[model samples]
Target: MGQGGSREFEGGPEGFPPGSERRSARQAEEAPQENAVVPTVLQWSQGGQSVYVTGSFNAWGERIPLRRSGNDCVVCLNLLPGTYQYKFIVDNEWRFAADQPTVRDEMGNINNCITVEDQTSFMREEQPSGFFDNNQNLYTQALPDEITLAKEPPQAPSHLWCLPLNFPPLCEPHVASWTLLPPLGVTLTHLLAAAADRSTNTLSVTQRVRSKFVTMVFIKPARGSAADARLGPAPAGGQAAGGGFALPQLPSTAAAVAAQQQL
Candidate 1:
């Protein structure tokens, strides 16, 4: 009698009966099956030695290679309903899908765009707050053992130049000349002409000074024949200096002289 009582107590409110345990085990096994993700196919029809897809979905960090299916390369992903931007790397060259929508990323490169929509919101609640919360773990689970994620691509180098500013007196009569020494292999014809003619107010001069290799510009007072007196005596090189006025030496280069002839 005591054995019977002990058995009944063991299968009480918090416990399952003998056969019920097996039923619960079967239910646990089937739970994941019920929540299984539907596969979405992404295919690239172009032929290449190797192809890959990388995008914002995986923090734009991991590259997922595609397998050849018939004439096309394809990849299957179980993505939640959302917009994603991606680009393909074919044999190491990056490209966008031909027929799909595209947009320029912050770096100015065009990327293919995609939108995933779930037929029902049933799986939405199961997803975490952010899809990439643990990007490494998510990527591991999303890809099969055969597929490998690629290393992050290197970024392009950027160049920026900052020029110093020198402002002359606004109301005072003055002459300004500027000399530009461009970096090696760079030419500044239009730039130099624009800089020299900016204060001249002569349209014809601007039109004439179109040399592509101009390196210097000189500006003088437009009015008054006594400009030399206002600027003081010419230096040994026949260039005026001092008294807030400077006359630059004439350009020596044949290309420069021809450009100056127009002014």
Candidate 2:
């Protein structure tokens, strides 16, 4: 299991490292575009079945009560700009999508995946290198013995969980039986992609996050009615404060222009 780092990264008070060369390079690269501010309603047809949709967004419901929306077990989530992994927990059994798959959990369960683009949900305020900070942490965390990367792409299945960003901390940490140790000097872009890939394939950690790439929800596929499922209003769950994957120490300050964005 990866433990939390005691010290923040040492850049400066504003937490942005000082430099123009790397900043300029990042500007040159193409990142995914932001499509909307509010999350568009996402719908899927399990067509007349009760599928329990759960993930880190919902504290990995010990039993996630699915929502009944007509014929589908509809769930809603508000996510930041990034990738997240999820799966369908159908009829009490965990399963990943048959397409677009990746790795397995510490308990040896595989998961399905989804990606929410950059600046989607949590960009209301400006914070430099928000997601990228977690990207750098992947390199620092100690790797478990079980995780390994797949040689090919994975599959995905469909179900729904209406996970909120402020989901409670999972009491039990989801582990990766087959984990991947990232190589040295990896960038945030590649790190995010890799974490997303892991969500499809590995067991989850207890830490909560909302990227399209990494989440936990895999269940057995069966035919049934979602209408039979019961769900009360979600607890007053709040969104995560941006703690994700592994994190390096935060920088102590920022450059002048970057510092001004904080005001």
Candidate 3:
């Protein structure tokens, strides 16, 4: 009995007592090992023969090459929750991220920027089955007939009616006043009526006759033509009154023939 008691008091192999080994094992089991949390991944979608990412995260010293998947070259970076400025090197040439936000560095060079946030609460709140939970009941209730009806077509513009109608002339006179004017007044009235007509052929003929008459009056002013007298003196620069229509120095007979043919 004494030998068994002494054996119990003595230590076990490796100087560890029998009960101590069991106690240490229990303590180790109670204090569980903690697993490392996976880092957040950042990805880029540009594809090239060779692509790499270098940024402030790596002190701009390391070049992480992107892996090509189908048409896109992507790189996975384990980033902490913070902002980062970076750029892509494609085919040995530097490039900024196409769609990411950018900021100018001290050297005036643009760099792509990104922000990371802790996703623990986001992961917990996300619903896999009902992705749009807020909008699910929105379409369940029927809408009113009036609300569902298609909107009325927009109204036409006010000036649409003016098309195909000749614009009014810049000058006008009462009937008695026109009669007091020279016989040229009657000719102008006829010309104005022809201009206001919607017929294209008639308008073309009137324009040609009017141009020829004005050219003739300016080039070889008739001794006492009523229109020429009423027009007063020609401006110093040879520009005619009533819109400064310049009289051609040399009128060609060919142009007159062409104008007549266009009538």
TM-score of each model, in listed order:
0.32, 0.26, 0.32
Off by over 4 Å in 3: 1-46, 123-263
Better of 1 and 3 by lDDT: 1
lDDT of 1 at 36: 41
> Residue by residue across 136-169, what tens digits does model 3's lDDT show?
5556576566665469898855543232224433
Question: Which of 1 and 2 is ahead in TM-score?
Answer: 1
User: Can you write out model 1's per-residue Cα lDDT over 77-172, one digit (the tens) per residue?
Assistant: 886555667777776667788877898655566778887765566645564466446456565445475535456787633321211112232343
Q: What is candidate 2's lDDT per residue for 157-215, written digit by digit as tens?
A: 22111122124444444745333332222222221221233123222222212221223
The total of clashing pairs for model 1 equals 0
Q: Against the unseen true structure, what C-alpha lDDT does each candidate score?
A: 0.52, 0.39, 0.51
Lowest summed lDDT over 10 consecutive residues: which window, candidate 2? 157-166
Model 2 reaches what TM-score against the true structure? 0.26
**What does each candidate score in C-alpha RMSD?**
25.5, 41.3, 23.4
